[model samples]
Target: MNAENEDFVRRRQLQVQRELEDATRDEVVVEPETGRLPVCIESALPSKCIVSFDAHESEVNALCWSPSGRLLASGGGDRKVKLWTVLRGQHQCMGQYLGSNRAINSVTFDDEENLVLAADNDMASRVWGVSDFRLKRS
Candidate 1:
């Protein structure tokens, strides 16, 4: 119809196309060689395991998933708890919570996903606020 109306329609169509593309895109797109999308991630629930990788220097003893499933917390024999961001079968360590005297044995996310609790072999348990990873006492 009018030029201004035609321009508005064109812009709307482009915007919709972009939204669709983003919706279907692989969530984790890192340097091609740095990450790989596993079959399990691509398929919601695969009956078999397809990919596996080492996420810690030593054996991983505990794991906790954020409420949203986008973040993963893992405690290992290295005496550290690592926070990982998982997407599209790719897991990247985003941060680390250290200070445990011994290897961490258990890790869990709080109900609100705002805190993480971890226990170490030294008979110490600590709580870390998810946002700043600060030691919390109360």
Candidate 2:
């Protein structure tokens, strides 16, 4: 590769590394009270969280199931948002978003489920493209 091309590649790599580092700088938290997730929740005991639920290690503040019910999104006190997809036999975590610098309080999917939106304690809101898990706007 030419020197100009190499320099461009190095700058791109550094940009990606910086973004990743920024994403990882979120606060850690411990579990809090249990509540019903805003989806097709099963009946629960007074004090139990569903075992297979995509629970955060800390408090979960918001949840939204896709329009087709094939995907689920959640945001929480852990400063992260996660996406779960339901297959024939199980729910799998397909992606985890750690770009929120503060606790997330609301999460929702667009009508077509092609995008996800979240609101954070920092008084900021963000939009992400579901297909590539990239930030579309903030």
| Candidate 2 lDDT, 2-80, residue by residue in tens | 9999899899999987776665564444334654343322332235533356468798899898999989898999998
lDDT scores for all predictions?
Answer: 0.82, 0.83
Residue pairs with backbone overlap in model 1: none
Model 1 gets an lDDT of 0.82
lDDT of 2: 0.83
lDDT of 1 by residue, 32-65 (tens): 6856754434422245765467878999999889
Q: What is the lDDT of residue 41 in candidate 2?
A: 26
Give the Å shift of residue 108 in candidate 1. Answer: 0.3
Clashing pairs in 2: none
Off by over 4 Å in 2: 1-51, 87-89
